[model samples]
Target chain A: GAGVSQSPRYKVAKRGQDVALRCDPISGHVSLFWYQQALGQGPEFLTYFQNEAQLDKSGLPSDRFFAERPEGSVSTLKIQRTQQEDSAVYLCASSFRTGRDGYTFGSGTRLTVV
Target chain B: AQRVTQPEKLLSVFKGAPVELKCNYSYSGSPELFWYVQYSRQRLQLLLRHISRESIKGFTADLNKGETSFHLKKPFAQEEDSAMYYCARSAGGYNKLIFGAGTRLAVHP
Candidate 1:
């Protein structure tokens, strides 16, 4: 792909429902990151991965938010029992090296929980 | 705690006017700063980084460790430059970026 791709550009989920967002990063990128952007706010870090290893999950808001990059190419972000506060845009970025190089961001998934 | 602050929520200017979006960060150690831009209905993209000291679309940002600021500036604003701008800092270890709330720039013709 020419750039990072994310699935389900928009999603509407009822409170307590579960939603899954997918990200396919640039082929062979070494680092993948997930971020959440609230309305009128900047994107906040959610988690990070180096290759297939989950190097950092400290940014995940809660146990309800889980992200995995099993193969290092594609990743998924899952939010269980979604709450209204969870409504926001989820963005995925990939970099060829550690972030000093720069990151390419996906279109993002806008999730609305009602 | 590491944090980025963009004080202005919106900045309006006439085309050809000078523009500056303010940003400040609080981090324990030396940090790398960057400016990201988002156009209407488009994905977010990198505009410039302090380390690069390069200008893109006539925009430049310089990291000021003395004042803890990284402000984006342009000599002449363009109508096409209307977009949302974010200031971010790279965290030390994991390299995750901490972003400011964002500033919306509106350039009118």
Candidate 2:
């Protein structure tokens, strides 16, 4: 792909419903990251992956938040029992290396929990 | 804990005026600082990093260790420069970036 790709650009979910956001990273990129951006705020790190390995997930806000990149090329973020506070933009980024090389961010998925 | 701080939520500048977006950080060890910009309805993109020490689109940022600041500056602001700018700091080693609340730059003609 020319750049990182994310699915379901916008989503509306009722509180307590589950939502899945997908990300297709640049081919062969070694690092993938997920971030959450609240209204009027900067993106906050959610998790990170190196290849197929889930290296870090310390940033995931709660047990309800889950992310996976089983094959390394594509990733998904799943939120269980979404709450109104979970409404935000979820961004995915890819880097050729460990992100010291800079990142290319996707358009992001805007999730609204009502 | 590593954290980035961008004090101004909004900055308005007339065309050709100088522009500066303040960024500061708090990290225990050495950190990597970067600036990312997002145009209206566009994806976020890297503007520059302190490690590169290079200017892009007339914007430059210098990392000040003593003050823990990495402020982005442009000598002449253009209308096209209107966008949301984010300040980010990478935890040492192979870590993800921590971003600050963004600053919206409005460059008016």
Candidate 3:
């Protein structure tokens, strides 16, 4: 069985540049989540989606960050005007019904902002 | 806000010795806890969940509501057990896992 998968395993962006990361969750999963992990730190919540509906995005660090899960299966995280501080690994995970079922995570996209 | 604390950043033990990686959490309401492990050059994977109460890879963790802790323990640590371990918590339907900084355990023969 396929697990959650991410694209562009690695990316390097200059300061102020825009970048987009993609995530493909397990089939039929209703809940999808995105997290950002800085160097030597644990993953931090960024946004969440249940089906095509974005239930919460409070974890997005700034207005420059945006995420969408239009079909409830694929998700894209876009960061506009990236800063050096934004350099981190972006991880995507999915579960059956949010809190009830365990989540399966992808290898993640390591974005390095210069 | 829910938070997880891993007292040690790194732990080193002999391959045949007992291993214990501590985890503590703080949340106002009842929250589910979990232990996730990441091997070198591999993606992070779930080790165990408090609700399931099952052991994996000879490792076990018990949630102590009184102490607000869930510590991972193995009777005889194996060299394969060396990896990065993270403690996590989930509250409500958020599906947002609050994770600790993580602990790196190294087992030597």
Candidate 4:
């Protein structure tokens, strides 16, 4: 694809429902990242992947949040038992090399937990 | 711990006026800093980086290690420059970027 792509631009989930967000990074990009942006706040790191390896998951807020990049091409973020605080914009970004190389961000999926 | 902070939530200026957007960061290790901008209906994109030391669209930011700041500045603001700006820090040699709250720049004609 021309740029990083995310699906379900917006998601409305029940308080206890589970939702999945998908991301298709730039073709052949080596690194992928997931971030969550709360209202009036900047995007905060959620997880990172190098190829198919999940190297960093330190930023994941809770056990309910899980992300995977099975083939190192496309990734998925799953939230279990979504809460009101989980409502935010989920952004996916990819970098050709490392963080020093900069990143290309997707439009993001806005999740609204009602 | 690495953290980025943009003090002003909103900045208003008339077109052609000089504009400065403040950014401050705290990181014990050497950090890679960047400024990202988002125009209406556009994805977030990199505007400049401390490592690049290059200006984009006449806007430049100098990383001041002593002050722990990387403030974006432009000689004259343009109406087209109105957007949301974020300051970010990259540390730990990872592909993770910690971003600030962001500043909304309003360049009025």
Which candidate has the top score in DockQ?
A: 2
lDDT of 3 at A51: 98
Interface RMSD (Cα, Å) for model 3:
1.2
Candidate 4 lDDT for residue A74: 98
lDDT (C-alpha, whole model) for all candidates? 0.94, 0.94, 0.92, 0.94
lDDT of 3 by residue, A1-114 (tens): 389999999999999999999999989988999999998999998989999999889899999999999887899999999999999999999988875557899999999988
Judge candidate 1 at residue A102 and give its lDDT. Answer: 78
* RMSD to truth, every model: 0.8, 0.9, 1.0, 0.7
TM-score of candidate 3 relative to the true fold: 0.98
Total clashing residue pairs per candidate? Answer: 0, 0, 0, 0
Interface RMSD of each: 0.9, 0.8, 1.2, 0.9
The digit string of per-residue lDDT tens for model 2 on A74-112 reads 999999999999999999999999999789999999999
As for candidate 4, its clashing pairs are none
**Per-candidate interface DockQ score:** 0.85, 0.87, 0.77, 0.87
TM-score per model over all chains: 0.98, 0.98, 0.98, 0.98
Q: Write one digit per residue (lDDT tens) for candidate 2, span B43-94.
A: 9999999889998999999999999999999999999999999999987467
- List, residue by residue over A14-64, the lDDT tens digit for candidate 4: 999999999999998999999999999999999999999999999899999
The TM-score of candidate 4 is 0.98
How far residue B34's Cα lies from its native spot in candidate 2, in Å, is 0.1
Taking the tens digit of each residue's C-alpha lDDT, what string does model 4 give over B1-109?
Answer: 6789899999999999999999999957888899999999999999999898898999999999999999999999999999999999886677489899999999999
Q: Which CAPRI quality tier does the interface of model 2 achieve?
A: high
